[model samples]
Target: MSGARHREEDLLRGISASAGMAIGPLRRYELPLPRVAETAADPAAERQALAAALETVAATLESARHSADAQGQQEEAEIFDAHLAWLEDPALREAAEHHIAAGSSAGQGWYAALQAEIERLRQSESALLAARVDDLRDLQRRVMAPLAADAGAAEAADDDLDGAILIAREMTPSQFVAVAGRIQGLCLAAGGATSHLAILARARGVPCVMGLGEALLSLTAERAVLDATHGVLESAPDAERLAALVAERERRQAQARSAAEQACAAVITRDGRQVQVAANVGSAAEAQAAARAGADGVGLLRSEFLFLGRAAAPTREVQRREYAAALAALDGKPVIVRLLDIGADKQLDYLSLPAAPNPALGERGIRLWQTFPELFETQLDALLLAGNEAPVADAATPLQLMLPMVSDVGELRWVRQRLAARAAELGITRLPALGVMIEVPSAALCAVSLAREADFFSIGTNDLTQYVLAMDREVAGLAAHCDVLHPGVLRLIQATLEGARGRCPVGVCGAAAGDPLAAALLVAMGVDELSLEPAGIAALKAWLRELDAAALAARVPELLALDDGAAVRAVLAAWLDASAPRGFGVMSERRGHTHNKQ
Candidate 1:
């Protein structure tokens, strides 16, 4: 021990989840559910107690919302509106009462009601609603925390999570919400950039860096400097380094503001190639933010948000109205609505799916359509009516319907046939242009035949990589192998592009499309469009504007011949280091980076 050298600031590099900087002590956050009994002596008293707890939660949300507004955190504040409304919802109130009336403790009844509501919402086709499960779960945990005998200790634990840089292996969206605005920064050992955790973090302006390995757990230093812009973590940074990073943080914020101001302008390459830059949004709030970010159109409109915090599937009218609102917000721009792609990562609890040993390969994507055709059918019906509504879609491009998890021509054909039937049933002559998500490896491999049935193709690189590699990225142990840059994954992309080249417009809407290096490769592979979160549009546009697609296109053959993702990444990195514009600060890392931008 005497001869051992003491390291000065251990450096940990990770993927940038959000852009910002923080200097604080590292704190770890962990929460476990409390055990509550089912029986109670006074049902009415239990119900009353539950109501009071809900009131407390409401006050908390309202205060946070107002704080967000006053601090100029409009989007972050808007996130609480739904939570506030959920508090007043009669249905939610009744569910908890029903459980209490059934002779359960107030805590147990509330927990049961919360679980029921989550299940009901989980079945929703709206992407926004589906994403709310975490928040709802978080709310449930909060209300039940103090119900235990150690309520005081639990509250103290919650308070301790504030005012520190959180270092975690993973955090759910709701957990992130609990510490959202209060935390200085966050570093996770695992999580896709496009995961809900990342999105929620960005909403609150909390800097996050994810995908660091387990080595992050070994750091003992309390004080550290976090630079999310570069995904760097420095333990016990010296004065000079800290000063430079702090200054860089200020410069980046200014750049972000300037970029947002001009986000609406068309993205044109230096050599004159105009590429369509659009936003992949789930909620209406995000849609508006996308417009402010200067998105050409909504490349992905997730349908699951409508299902959160309630038990019933959203009525057709509700779905139509929500879709209409999103379109109206986009002004006359085109919007591609992806049908509920729930299953696997996002499960529909109400479906009562049996415990599967391998859910990832089980009923997910198009496979869900087989077991629950009625759900997709109802959604399809809504899409037809909504698309045909005059106020919903003006002279702009007609709203497009996209089926997730289409693995073959047959699946694509099934939806195509169903669409035709739905249009006829609704007495509609014009049908929305149909598209399929090429997320499944089989779908990419069979893209040629699918092109004949579908009008367009949108590659979901995240799932495609997972399915092709047979590795679930959600599992922390397997995250390293779930990369989209692998040679096999890119080959599938290449095949899909080759098959759909002349037949339909092929685009990528996954997190990978947001990466500057991967975006270049995607362009090289003949992708006609790239969609990502609106926050990344300005940076990606700045980076893409410098190089010619033709120049990158010439390297496609060589890229495809690479032995592995590492080689592919290294080659792309070298190319960028040699060719990327020096003007945009678009320097590539030594080996470049991959993984979808969350």
Candidate 2:
């Protein structure tokens, strides 16, 4: 239809939620909120009705949680957990009760209670907190649906949006779950990278961009190009522009396919040094994607996904199945499973640990594990059992267990004791290789001592940068300051490498590993492994084949002496420009300073 018209091309920029490119017809999707009517009611009866509606909604959310988990959507299941927590909040119930006592009906009281909280969240200083308003609204709708006089009031038929990029002011998880597989792409006028919708979009591999603002509403294009990688949407493109986009898309696809086909091979630099390029996966599905993308193995397997969203800690067999399935998906590739890393930031209702004023700087990761031995012992048992049942990987690619947020060698030693004890109890002869994640400044500073105990070391640059700069990654609009390329952060990385001192494999499994400039720098710094997102694997591999790692190693001192992240970026950009043949289009095109560019 777009080809039939001669329309002017217009480009709109927004925050990218997921990375990919899609061209399709535009379909505006609008989900109507369930309405509640004001009515006179007996206060006591209204209170009872409110209680019953809350329980019903809570039960529905619990059911959805189980269903999502069954379908391998652990993240979506976690969203329901948050909703359930809100549903049972005593303050919310008391607010509705007060309204009911003041003569409002149950539906009206509940609506008012939720709206007050939503408004408060919207006014919060933290953008991450404010972005949760849609989640609250979703709760409002679920509860109101059961409370509405007409039982079928909120029921709506699914739209035929297949092969179309759906645009909305904002979307709730409930609406997204219903049509996630049907939509080709997604565009939102309002949402940040931390929103539940954005998480779901990324998990589903949907090409999505959000926070497009009022400009999105004015888009009248019948067909458009959604380049989520760059957060650009080309609307109402003319024939020439459309053809160019189509060609570009095809070329990118072909390049990706070719790179992936060659990715499984060992990555040996021109100087005859071999480096492992791996993936950081959270689920079995992700592991399969990594294998397809030609990842050497999985460097960081986030085991926390299994623990979250559930009422109790996952049983040994349950965690074992999930872990084993992930290993099986990768055939014989190695997997370094990080034990439960939850704390105040990522709390489990079942685990009652001491309260901390600052969750980030307080009891978390290995500390949390130490505080609750029973919680982590089961996971250790699961890992041991999984390795036994899963496919036997290469001797060089043995299964590994990693400890998170370990600031000292004492914590690593403690975990090793527990893991060894668990393996013995499980009658396993050989223990899996144990490692530590160098996410904290203390850990990076003491990497040498940790490497003496740890079988390997994985640098989590995202957290390391945040910790080094005292900048929280969740704080919106601070992305520029929280850059991993900062000289201080790079110096810490250099220290980590020096600590390893060829004693063990030191890998970076953070944002830096996926970034072309950072990845190149890490390779030059003598990092033995680089584990990144699955999508970035192939392109990085293609680019690495053209790199002279030994030659780049000579330039490391120059980078380490750089004043700031911008200067470091400028230098890397120049190097990329000088090496024209090695310019992998996807990696060379920098996405610096992208707001909410998750």
Candidate 3:
């Protein structure tokens, strides 16, 4: 195996969980999960032990829930709430007590009760019920902490790991939060690219590489260069190597700044293909900035932001004003607003969502509207109100509305009926361009059906990739296989395109759209629009200019035929290297050679 521990002047490689480069001191932090012990014990002692463990787990959950609620992490708080309910379940408490009374250790009792409950839930017809097994597993870790042999060590440590390249065997979601700002880079022996740890790492703008293997765990270097852009960790690097890395980092930052400077221009590929580059903004201020940056338009408004950070739901007029302000900021450009995609990762305090062990598959997205009619109706009313009041010139901007988590034609028909009713009620003849988000595997498969009724299609690759591979993006263990480049995900995108044919405009607004590599591939996939974060607009624009659409499009069949993400990446990398046109020394120097032939 090529994976080896570097004692001195050597390099280790792993998956790039985040894109960036960091030079920092190496700090090792290990938070070992406590092991459950099963042993015979007196009924009295077992009861006492069980009670203590329950108290600790409950207190921890309640604290986290309250803290999350205060910090606008309402969605995260729901996760803790579910754990608290499980702890207070009468049946679960009774089962555990029975085991304790039977002379089982507290750990044994707790494990038995959790397993029995999970098994019962798994037998249910509902898929959400079956998914609760993960929640139960997460609870076991927290509950077992106080009961484990190393309970004292489970407590918080005093060391500060900020500004350090954190190395660990595995990191939980909580660990990422604790050392968030302080950690300049992250290296883990476990978890995958799309794990919760990886997600947080990226959000914090920290360079992170995971699934690095066992040798990295014992790394004791005081300082190292963590190049997460390419997933390379260098220890005791030669001076020459350090200088080269530093220079490369600077060049990338320069390129990023230049891309932003040229943000207002249209991005056309070398093969003469024009791609619409847009932004995903949450507020009017961001919308204004996107316009200044020269974005084609807003891709996703994340309308849930309107309902969050408040004690009650905002009035319909309140939503309309906010939506109107954002539309005005766009300066007549088209904006695609996805209505209230809450429940999984995003939640609203006013909405009473059922506690699900796995909320991602729960009553979220378009499902939330069906369960709560008023929610969807009010939002639709606001969109129509804002649309009708828009100026004649900007009215051509088209207030595009998109539905999320739609599974079947019935759901589309139901929402369309509501939209038409709202438009009629408002005495509006021209309704906005209505669209469905092709996120769920079902919608992708039934795209032709949805296209026949809808005005346009916006593919949400984030949820689509996760569901297509059956990998939860939040699960650290499943990160490796959660890539959008997976053949299955690409096939589904192709499926949606084929089914829709030339019937509707298709756009991609997920994280994939923001990625330069994925953005290139997406255009090659014949995607009409590419919506990315504001910051990536320039590089993506520059990156687009490097691509030959016909060259990329012609190889679509071969690329789709490849079953492995790694194979797909290799093909694209080779193509980019070969086809990259000669540019200023800035971009070409980084690639080591110019595209002289091109």
TM-score of each: 0.79, 0.82, 0.69
Off by over 4 Å in 1: 1-9, 12-51, 54-141, 144-164, 167-183, 188-197, 210-223, 227-232, 238-258, 390-397, 583-598
Ten consecutive residues with minimal summed lDDT in candidate 2?
589-598
Q: List the residue pairs that clash in candidate 2.
A: none
Q: In candidate 2, residue 57 scores what lDDT?
A: 88
lDDT of 3 at 14: 74
Candidate 1: residue 289 Cα off by (Å): 1.5
Model 2, global lDDT? 0.79
Query: Which of the numbered candidates is closest to the native, going by highest lDDT?
Result: 2
The Cα local distance difference test for each model comes to: 0.73, 0.79, 0.73
Better of 2 and 3 by lDDT: 2
Considering lDDT, where higher is better, how would the candidates rank from best to worst? 2, 3, 1
| lDDT per residue as tens, model 3, 1-598 | 0122344447777776776778777888876446667765587887788888889888988899899767755335645665676676667778887988887778888888888877885674443344455467666667777887777774666365757888987765655666777777889885555344554565466788876789898787766788776567886765666677677678777877777777788888888889998888766656776787678988887787677556567789998998898889886788788888878756564577877887778888888776888877998999889877765564454578988899988888888898899889989877788888998999999989989988888999888987898876645445456778878899999999888887988899887786556677888888888886555566677777778888888888988789787788678767776777754222332121000000
Residues 7-75 of candidate 1: C-alpha lDDT, one tens digit per residue: 444778777667667878888765667666678999877877787878887888889889866775544
